[model samples]
Every structure is written in structure tokens, then in C-alpha cells.
Target: MEQPPVTPRSALHTRPKSQGCFLVGKSLKPVVAPIYKKNGIFYAEIFLNWSHIVGERYSRLCRPVRITGDKPNATLYVGASRAVAAEMFYSVPTLLERIHHYFGFQILESMRFVNDFSSPHMASTFSPKKEEAAPQNSEEADASWKGDDITYPPLREALMRFQSYMRKIK
Candidate 1:
């Protein structure tokens, strides 16, 4: 009788467990935004530029930014120059009143003015690029619209909303 050869166990059959790998050091608190928006308005919990200055000047100053809303929250982020920020800080309350008169709701809760030195990335990201001029006629616009169906929901909604608003005012 010939002796049978023994087979070795395959290393591919064994694998490491990864069940709790994602849960490590997880926090329960909602991370407050450096900025946020609700109901077509924008809010910021912290002014990073201001915070940096305060942190530099005083060792013991501590403050958490607060935002309040009752319903239908929407948040937006806009990057502006230091001059615009200063204007916003000084004029936002009066501006809000005018906005409410026109829109029938308060859109912005509060704003924080930040110095231009703080966030260069924001200004760069939103800066518009020079592009070929868009077609002027409806046919061109329709053709552009029909070329891609999957990615146009937001654009379509905005156009529809504008159209509706225009019709309502007319």
C-alpha cells in the first residue's frame, strides 16, 4: 500500500475580524459647524478668524456659538471679503428686516464677520473661472438641458422656482 500525501491548510481561508474597527474613538455629540444654514439662510457657530484672534489675545476666554431655529432649517456658506464681512456684521439686523419684508420669512439668523487673513481656501474654491460664453437662445439652453438627465435635478428645480416666482409677481 502507498502512503497518501497530506495536504496543507490554505492561508487564504483565514481572515482578520473587522467588526468594531469603525467605532473606535467615536463621539456622541453633533459636531457644530464652523458655519451652517437653515430655511434658505446661513448661520455660523464660530467665526474662525475671530476665534483665532481671541485665542491669541486672551488665554481664558471661552465661548460657544449658538444658532436658533424653530422649523425647516437650511444652511449655506458664502465666502466674502473682509469689507463685506464688516458690512454684514454691522448691517445684518436691518438687512434681515428688509429680507423678511420681501420674502415673508426671516432667512438669516445671525452672521459673523471674519478677517480675510483667516480663510484663503474658501475664497479660492468659490472664485469663478473664466469660461466660454453660454449660448443666448432657448434652443441652446434646451439642448444643453437634454444632454444629461441624471445631474440636472437641482438646476431644474432652481429654474422652476424662478419661473414660478416670476409668474407670481406678474
Candidate 2:
């Protein structure tokens, strides 16, 4: 019988449990750093919290597409409609300040406003989805009757709060 030469794969497979390797969150930095750096994004968290970075008023009117350039003063590409493009341009200075404040540093120096007519229009009126009301249990029904007897506003409020809390747990 001949002994086989140890290969990298075989070595890795035969490695002892104590010597095994595992990748942590920091290990992924090398792979993820290039993507953000290429797009000039300082942090991925900003994209997830986009609405907060840009105030509620401007959140729908415009959206940040991407950041360009490696400088601290990178160009922020914004998608908007022709109707608001001029208005948005005039507010660029204020917008820049807001963005800087958001990141706690100067991440953008200028805005490249792109008029995108095809982009979906944001509705002027917002109607949030109504949460389904929980069914009334016997305990809640009994509590309601007791609450009705008490005309004291403070006591009634406390009862209502208790009922709501019970409903959530149930």
C-alpha cells in the first residue's frame, strides 16, 4: 500500500476539530468593503434608513440613487421629476447640510439631480394599512361592563389600558 500525498482539501478535511477555521463578521469586511467603496457609500445602514436621513417632506419627492467619487465631498445622485427638479436644485445647499448632519460628517458636496419621468409616482395622500382588531374575549367583555359603571375618567382610562394590554398578550 502507498501513502497518499496530503492536499489542501484533504488537509482541511483531516484537520482536528480544535484547529478548524470559521469566519466572523469582520472577515466579510474585505468582500463588502470594495462594493461600498466603489459606490462611494460610507455605510449600508443609510440606505436602510433612507427615509430618516432625508426628512419626511423630501423623502418622496426625491431619492438618493448612488454616491460618486472617493472624496469626502462625493456627488450624490438624486432621482426626481422635472416638476420638482428646479425646486430641489435651489434647496441643494440645505439638503447637503442635512445629509452631512445625518452621517455626522461631510459625505456629499453636490447633488446630481436626474429627472426620471418613468419612476413610479409617490401618492400625495398616505393611508396606512389598518390593523385587524382583536376579537373580544369573555374577560374583555366583562371588563367593559365594569368600566361602563365607573364614570371616573382616570379609572376608565386605566381599565382601557389594562384591556389593551391583555388583548396584546392573548
| TM-score of each model, in listed order | 0.24, 0.50
The TM-score of predicted model 1 comes to 0.24
Q: Candidate 1 on 47-78: residue-level lDDT in tens?
A: 34333423432212222233345322422233
Whole-model alpha-carbon lDDT for candidate 2: 0.73
lDDT of model 2, residue 51: 74
Q: Give candidate 1's whole-model lDDT.
A: 0.45
Writing each residue's lDDT as its tens digit, candidate 2 over 3-85 gives: 89867877776856685666686798898888867754564655567678878888778777767766475788888787778
Model 2: residues with Cα > 4 Å off, grouped in runs: 1-30, 36-43, 118-170
- Which of the numbered candidates is closest to the native, going by highest lDDT? 2
Report the C-alpha displacement of residue 28, candidate 1, in angstroms: 34
Please give the RMSD to the true structure for each candidate, in Å.
20.8, 13.2
The candidate scoring highest on TM-score is 2
